[model samples]
Target: MNAIEVENLRKEFKSYSSRSGLVGAFRDLFTRNYKIIRAVNDISFTVKQGEMVGYIGENGAGKSTTIKMLTGILTPTSGKVIVNGMNPHKEREAFVRTIGVVFGQRSQLWWDIAVQESFRLLKKVYRVSDKDYNEHMNHVIETLDIGPLLDKPVRKLSLGQRMRCELAAALIHNPPLLFLDEPTIGLDVLVKLKIRQFLKEINEKYNTTILLTTHDISDIEALCERVIMLDEGKIIYDGSLQKLKETWGEGKQIQFTFVSEMSLDTLKELTDGLQVTWKQGEQANVWTAHAPSALLPEVISRVVNRYSIQDLNINEISTEEIIRNIYEEGVVHG
Candidate 1:
């Protein structure tokens, strides 16, 4: 079953044109001249149950607007959004009951309350039975390692601590769908890793569907199997992460450090066919071209014969570089 479905979804807001002066501001308020700013253009996609999907885009690209519509916090101007086979905006209460939302910059927990107290309040708000609530809370605390932080007031806890509590609070209701927006933003490396692991485990064990939005590519790389990329409020690409890599990620870099200070011009003369993408000093050089995989051994042999060998490294271009290239140089589909 599809956990979330959007079809030709469109949202627009009235944006007024005004000058910088007080007269212009007064005229704008009185005249009400405005233009339609389409925050979310006609875009469509479906996310199946138990799938971990990454929704990524740059700032002001309507990512938050889309999430708000899905969570029933905002209504779209046109088109349809169905969550768990129900219209989210129309069935706000029922829709909210089945999903949990976490925004990294915001807090759902009470500032003055202890972490455990907030959990108890959530238990009542969701009307969770004592037994089920205890079981779920125990499991979440154990998984997120928040047992040590349960008695501390939320305001007193550090960012990482508060983040773990936020995750625990969101999951306390045992919702089947989770919408996480930049959940690891500004977190330390160790805390980020722990959070990622916790999310992976929850998705695997509970079969929960997750739609994670973040600017951090590492988060998407570690968590999502499928990625939906948005640019200018439109769907640019949607596919398996590996396929995106294979399509845009071409060429590899080979770096070599010579044992002796051999002149770059001499090396270039010897390997003139190889595209020397970058050259630095007398000891290091990088090459990229349509060379066969077998050509590496032959090139190394020639280089060793001409100059003393020291160290060499060859690696494929990074995924970040590939995605950036795609965004900069738009993909042309045949």
Candidate 2:
């Protein structure tokens, strides 16, 4: 069964076209002009049960808007949104119970309450049984390492501490679906790593369906196998992450440090017919080459056999680079 089913879903908002200057300001006081903005254009997609899908796009690209619709926070202007076999907006109370949402910039925990107190409140709100709550809470606290944070007030905890608690709060009900919006935002590498690891473990252990929306490319790369890329409120690309990489990520930047200084002409002759382009570095012994990924083995083998290399560095196409290419140049190459 599909965890999420959205068909031609769209959201629109109105923005005031306020004019400048004294006369315009006086006119605007009496009358205001509005322009319609389609935050989410007609788009359609589905996520299978227990699947982890990345919903990615730049700011104002309707990522949050779509999430709002799915979570029943906002009503869609048109089209259909069904999450976990029920209409989110229509069946809000029951729908919310089946899903856990974490917004990185927002807090679901009460500001003045202790983290443990907040968890209890959530358990009460969700009506989780004592046995079930105890089991889940123990696992969550241990896995997220939030035992030290349980007694502290939500506002007193550090951002990382609070975020860890946030995950615990969301999972208190043991919901089948999880919606994460930049859960790792503003976190240091260590915190991000912990969050990613926790997410992976829960998804695997419980078969939880996850819809992760993030600008942190590493988060998507680490947790998601498929991505639904949005641009200007449109679904630009939706498919396997590996396929996206292979299709747009063939170029590689390889750097080599030779044992001895090699002249540019000698370097050129050595790499001839290898479909590689040479770029000189500041130091004569160090050189860089841009080549297709397919030719990496041939380039490395040829250079390794012929020359004594001190060091070699290979830089693969980053997820950011791939997405940037799709944005700058449309998905289809002519």
Candidate 3:
């Protein structure tokens, strides 16, 4: 079953022009003029059961707007959104009951209340049975490693600690679908790893369908099998991560460190047919080629014959770079 389905989902708002002066403001209050802003413009996609999908775009690219419509927070001006076979906007309560949402900038927990108390409140709101609530709480607490933080007030907890609690709270009802919006934002490396692991576990164990929106490419790489790229309120790219790389990321880098200094002119001449990107401390030079694997041996031989070799490293073009390039270069599909 498709966990979420959207067809031609478009949302628009009337942005009013505010007047600066008192007289203009008074006039505006009586005669308000506005322009139409299309926050989400006729975008469509479907997420099946047990699938992890990444929705990414720049600021004002309509990622959050799409998510809000899907979760039934904002009603779409046109088009359709069906979550678990129910129109989200019309059946808000039923739709919400089957899904969970976590926003990094927002907190559903009570500020002065302990984390445990917050979880208890969520349990009641979701109408989770005592037996199922305990089981789900134990599972999430163990997976997120937030047992130590349960007694701490949410206001006093660290960002990482609070994030773990938030995840635990979102999952206390054992919902089948989860929406995570920048769940790892402002987290340290260790905490980020922990949250990623927990997300993977939940998806695998429960076959929970997930739609994640994050600026962190690592989150997409580590979690999503499919990625939907949005730009200017449109779905620009929707496909596997590997296909995106193969289409746009065609170059790799070969970096070399020499034992002794070499003249820049001579080094440039030696490494012809490669784009020299950087040099380090008179000892290292980085070059880019269409295919590093095909050119590594020949490049190394020429560099070694001219200068003493120290260390060398070759790396494929990163996914983050590829996505950025696509956005800049504007990759369009029919």
Candidate 3: worst-modelled 10 consecutive residues by lDDT: 282-291
lDDT of 2 by residue, 143-197 (tens): 9999988888998998999999988899999999999998988999999999999
Angstrom error of the Cα, residue 171, model 3: value is 0.4
Compose the digit string of candidate 1's lDDT tens values, residues 1-334: 9999999999899987776688878887768777999989998999999999999877887899999999999999999999988899899877787999999999999999899999999888888999998887788899889999999999999999999999999998899999999999999999999999999999998999999999889999999989888877788888888988777665665666766555557866877776443455433443332233456676666777886666777778677766776676776322
Q: If scored against the real structure, what TM-score would every candidate get?
A: 0.83, 0.84, 0.85
Residue-wise C-alpha lDDT for candidate 3, range 40-122, written one tens digit per residue: 99998999999999999988999999999889999999998889889988887878889989999999899998999998888
The 0-to-1 C-alpha lDDT of every candidate, in the order given, reads 0.84, 0.91, 0.85
lDDT for residue 60 in candidate 2, whole number 0-100: 88
Q: Which stretches of candidate 1 lie over 4 Å from their true place?
A: 20-26, 254-313, 332-334
| TM-score attained by model 2 | 0.84
Backbone collisions counted per model: 0, 0, 0
Clash pairs, candidate 1, are none
Residue 158, candidate 1: alpha-carbon lDDT: 95
Point out where model 2 deviates above 4 Å. Answer: 254-314, 332-334
How far in Å is the alpha carbon of 121 misplaced in model 3?
1.0
lDDT of 3: 0.85
Between candidates 2 and 3, which one is better according to lDDT?
Answer: 2
